[model samples]
Target: MSAAEAEAAAGSEYPAHYKVMLEKLNEQRQLDQFTDITLIVDGHQFRAHKAVLAACSQFFYKFFQDFTQEPLVEIEGVSNTAFSQLMDFTYTATLAVAGEDEAFDVWKAAEYLQMQEAIKALNKKIDEFSSLAARSTSKKRKIAETSNVITETLPTVEGEHVEIQVMGEGAIEVEESGAGGSRRRCKKCSGIVRRLRFSSSR
Candidate 1:
């Protein structure tokens, strides 16, 4: 077998092992089994094991290792849902944030707790958002450029009369005294040749 195949086979062999371990740990946490610490956040109490938390979070590791033996620890500035999701992630290896706003909130909570994995997940989201924003900007720029070219290149002639019609948002239909004209269509602009038409699909 090739090295890549060997690696894939090896990975497949071990995938379920860690997943099962995480699920059992999550079950124990749900049952409050061998819980050593009680975390209070926004008037809500969460019972968890310090070892698991310390392993998952740098803040928890340092607090448990260097600080006092306080059984009840109060965390501030983090929302209930965010913290709940963080803890659920810490034990179950899953981050189930509802939407973008909640994902950002979880990111804040993860940053405060200094959790590398959750922070990395949030980083992926940020990268995805940046990519989407860049694509949108590029599309808008293309549309604007196309519109500018039509307005500037086409000069006012005596025979051809230009009529403007606003069909939809960012959509304009320019009618010239001509027929058999080729029509070009895109999300941002359409019928760009001869008789310029704007499409609102984009």
Candidate 2:
């Protein structure tokens, strides 16, 4: 168990203390100081504290528990970018990814490492991204549907000069030009209109 785990198991809640400790540990990692383990992923190297890794990841916890006199380990199946981001999360309890590829790699690495908390956070982000994409697609579909409805409403009439206007929010005014110059108005729209316009030459 790590020092943080011990503190948590003792039912102690020292947010400030834990924050400072993690900050210091991250600094040590940056300086390559006191890191007892070296992980190689896809030929990229990472130096980190084993206890911290064990505390954050079930895979790492078991890996070190069975490890004997091996300070260096080679990892497979995950990209280096993901492992780096997961390491950052382990130290600071936060992750910062600059792009989509980095985000995907981090999520993949977190799963492979069996980081439950990280996976929950990543899932939330995935939900948010999915919602955003859905909304955009819906808006585009609405616009296309509106255009198609207007085109369908306008039949092929010779010398047709129909002037259409939107009435309030949900109504429309249709004016037909001819000898009578007839006009039609409605309070509620049953169909969308506006995408079709009669050719001036016609």
Candidate 3:
């Protein structure tokens, strides 16, 4: 048949997860829901002879970015107390005005710990704030043909003491008078026109 159909058929012939890493990734996705182990890049969790609590704190801090308010490390699975300390330490460290090096260190630790969301946010912030040119180019561009309409009021003498006013764009005619109230009509379709009132007085 067609080339596109042939390519689609060929693609469906192969089995998914053909690579070893892909199989491991799928297994990790399954085990991630059940695992209690705290994996971090650095800071003694992986260190030999360190207390389990200390290692857990290091792992949580490094992976999760901040651990100050969290009870993650001491929970039964990961221990909520250790997690709290890690979170606290991370928050305090991140807030320090003079701790750029420490922040970078912690980021590295988090990266090593495989804290995916923290790594992504930190990287995004860095990229966004690093260059003025990049930041300027990232601004959204607005489309034309969408803008405010300017209405002009024209007064006409209708009767002895009544005055008529016409307003709005050339496509629509909105006629109003002190005695007759208001009337609207579309120039192109001859349809009845509707007047919309603004909420603000100004």
TM-score for each candidate, following the candidate numbering: 0.59, 0.62, 0.21
Please give the lDDT score at residue 42 for candidate 1: 53
lDDT, each prediction: 0.64, 0.64, 0.33
lDDT of 3: 0.33
How would you encode candidate 2's per-residue C-alpha lDDT over 106-187 as one tens digit per residue?
7766766678888777666655655665676777879877532211111122343323232222533333335875444442
lDDT by residue (1-202, candidate 1, tens digit) is: 9999988878755688889998988888888898877665654567899999999998788767754455655565677778888998888877666555677778877776779998888666655655665677777879777532211111111232222232332332222223775343322332221121212221
Q: Return the TM-score for candidate 2, rounded to 2 decimals.
A: 0.62
Per-residue lDDT for 109-192 in model 3, tens only?
A: 344334444444445444444443333434422234334433322222122121212223334322322366544443331222
TM-score of 1: 0.59
| TM-score-based ranking | 2, 1, 3
For lDDT, the strongest prediction is 1
User: RMSD in Å for candidate 1, one decimal?
Assistant: 26.1
Model 1, runs deviating above 4 Å: 1-13, 129-202
